[model samples]
Target: MKFEKESCSVKELVDDLYLAHQLLVPTHLRFSKEAEGDLFIYTDKKRLSQVITNFLTNACKFTNSGYIKLGFKHLRGTDEAAIFVEDSGIGLSEEEQEKVFSRFFKQDEFSQGAGLGLSICQGIVQNLGGRIALSSKLGKGSRFSVVLPVYKGG
Candidate 1:
């Protein structure tokens, strides 16, 4: 891992991710326009891209009709910020959510992944001084949030 954090344009990062996977979703599916103005964050672009793409790819795989949103926001009254992956797909139960990030944990054995994406995401976020969170309800959908501190002075 490069593990380098430097001043970088968030817009560039977002655009890259969008271009990389936008076509993978079924032609009829559309990404939500949830991204806002560009904001800089000191971070490793590669790892962050990996994390975001992992979330997006998983969401797209499970979602067939509704939208998937990827966006960033600064927590109100705080320097903390987050990148979120929200999807309208089969949601998980509390018991399932507990092991969502565990190695080899798979929601469905027949799903395409090797069960390493979320576990890797958690590690990457933790190394970046952030944490990955999930909020979901069975039969509704899931939202995965990766929270981190904004750079004070990179």
Candidate 2:
């Protein structure tokens, strides 16, 4: 798929996603944002938004309670910005984390949806010339992060 890449504000995208998914947070869960200022990146907004939405949706679904935080910031001296979603909910084991991005992979068989979200997200990030990362521990929580090149000048 061809992505319509462009220079866009990371803060704006985070704000939009936060607003779009705020009401969807479970009553037992609290949502927050860690993005402070307007950081810019050169990428496809719609595709990146999809990746983030998937992160938020999974965070809400797996998290029984606690907080889900969305964050974005520049990696100092790296010319890249990291966008991440962290949840204090059910996380993955070492084996699970290794295969979480595989197509049709699901931690819970009973969970809804076809297990294609993360795989698609990885593809999207890669197409945008970025890399996606994940950190988690069983019974703790998980964090999904995507780092993209920051938008310099035109």
Candidate 3:
């Protein structure tokens, strides 16, 4: 896949996504986002959106009744931007976390997917010169983040 990397406003993307996925959020779960100001990133906007979409989708599926949050965090002097999806859901064990990004690995055998969503997300982030990270604990929750270089455009 070809990526048309460009400068995109992180805030705007989050706003659009929040609106677009409103219907997908389960009635028993709470959904929210945290995007402050006009954070910018130099990357393929569509690809980034795809990664976040997968994160949110998985979070909702595993979480029976909890909160899912999408947030963008940029440290004042850091060179990276972190766009993340966090959830209070059925988290992963150390073993599952190690293989979560592998091509066809799924923690839940009955889950309705080919288990490619996270693998694809990893590929997309790598192609965009970023890294995808996950933090989770069994029966607690999880946070998936895509960290990329910040856009320094004037």
Candidate 4:
């Protein structure tokens, strides 16, 4: 995918995501209260949106009914911003977490998808000079965060 970086609003991006997935009602989706105002970041909007979209899609898939939160926080004392998508869905185990981002890796052998979602997310974040992380507990839920350096204008 082609990537063109420029100053973009995180709020708008997150809003788009929330709108797209908002109808999952019993599975309420919202932006974190801590995410306020317009936070600008330099990156490829499409690529970043794709990564966030993937995270939300997965969240919507695994979560039968609960809440999914999308938000970003400017990391203090650091030049990075943390964009996270969290879901109250089936969580992954420690062993599964290790393999979740591996190409063609899926927990359930019969599940849909080529198991390339997280792997692609990793590459996209890395391409944007960022990294993705995960925290999950089996039967509880999962949280995925992508940390990208905040863009400072030249």
Candidate 5:
């Protein structure tokens, strides 16, 4: 499938998140917003949502109990924003963190994913002049953060 990039407004993006939440309501989902600034970014709209969705999906799959939080914060002294999707689920190991974004890298031995989700997220973020990172502790949780440059007018 061909993927096309599009511009998205922060408010609209949150709306999309709500829609996705509605679809997954049966999964006992919870959302908490902690955005501090105007959450706007210049990137592929569809792919960006895909990134968040993938994170949430993975969280739900690994989490047996506890809450998932989608948080946002703008870094000071820069026109960059950080979006974090944190989950209180079974986290990854140090070695897995190093290769989480690598192509075809799956932590779960029984997982059937092609392992391109995070890889695609990395490429999309890089293409938009941004970076992606993650932090996790086994038996604790994982937090995936994407730092993207804000789109200013020409």
Candidate 6:
């Protein structure tokens, strides 16, 4: 996969999310938004989308009842925007959180994919001069937040 950075519009990014939302409906998926202001980021759109998609897919796999929420907010005094994907599913432990972003690390047997999603996300966010973090409580849920800088000239 090419790792070059690219400028992407908020509308375009949301469009991809909308498509994912469609696929999520049959699984009883739902999204709650509290996004204000324009959402934009300076990063590879494909890679970022992959991150969000992976998060959402994981949420669906773990959450059998409550909904998954995607939120967007801007950081003041900086060109950074925060995107959060939260789910009311089986959460991870503190130890698990420590290695969630490590390559090929999987929390348990319930997880799917090659276990490289979070690792890829960390690399992508770092490549864009950003950071990714997570918070969770076992049996409660988990939230993955990606902080990315907005493209100032695009």
lDDT of 1 by residue, 1-154 (tens): 5598777666677777777777776776678646666667778888888898899988888777788877777777977777788988888999999999999899989988789889989999888778887999987889998777777672
lDDT of 4 by residue, 1-154 (tens): 7789999888788778677756643425443423766677889999998898888778877877667788888878998788898877889999999999999998777878999999999999999988998999988889899898877777
Q: Which candidate would rank higher by TM-score, 1 or 3? A: 3
Per-candidate clash tally: 0, 0, 0, 0, 0, 0
Residue-wise C-alpha lDDT for candidate 5, range 1-154, written one tens digit per residue: 3456555465557556756665573356565555564666677777777777787778777777777777677778988777778888899999888888899898886886888888888887777667887889999999888788766645
What lDDT score goes with residue 58 in model 3?
95
Q: Candidate 3, residue 66: CA error in Å?
A: 1.1
Regions of candidate 2 where Cα sits further than 4 Å from its true position: none
Candidate 2: tens digits of C-alpha lDDT, residues 1-154: 8789888999999999988988888877889999767788888899899899999999988999899999998888888899999998899999999999999999998999899999999999998999998999889999999999888877
Model 6 TM-score, 2 decimals: 0.84
Best by lDDT: 2
Flag regions of model 4 displaced more than 4 Å. Answer: 24-34
Q: Is 2 or 6 the stronger prediction by lDDT?
A: 2
Q: What is the TM-score of each candidate against the true structure?
A: 0.91, 0.96, 0.95, 0.89, 0.84, 0.84
Q: RMSD of each candidate?
A: 1.5, 1.0, 1.2, 2.2, 2.4, 2.2
Report the poorest 10 consecutive residues by lDDT, candidate 3: 33-42
Estimate every model's Cα lDDT from 0 to 1: 0.81, 0.91, 0.90, 0.82, 0.75, 0.77
* Model 1 accuracy (lDDT, Cα): 0.81
**Model 6, C-alpha of 78: deviation from truth (Å):** 3.8
Q: After aligning candidate 2 to the native by TM-score, how far in Å is the CA of 13 from where it should be?
A: 0.8
In Å, residue 42's CA in model 2 sits off its true spot by: 0.9
State the displacement of the C-alpha of residue 19, model 1, in Å, after optimal TM-score superposition: 2.6
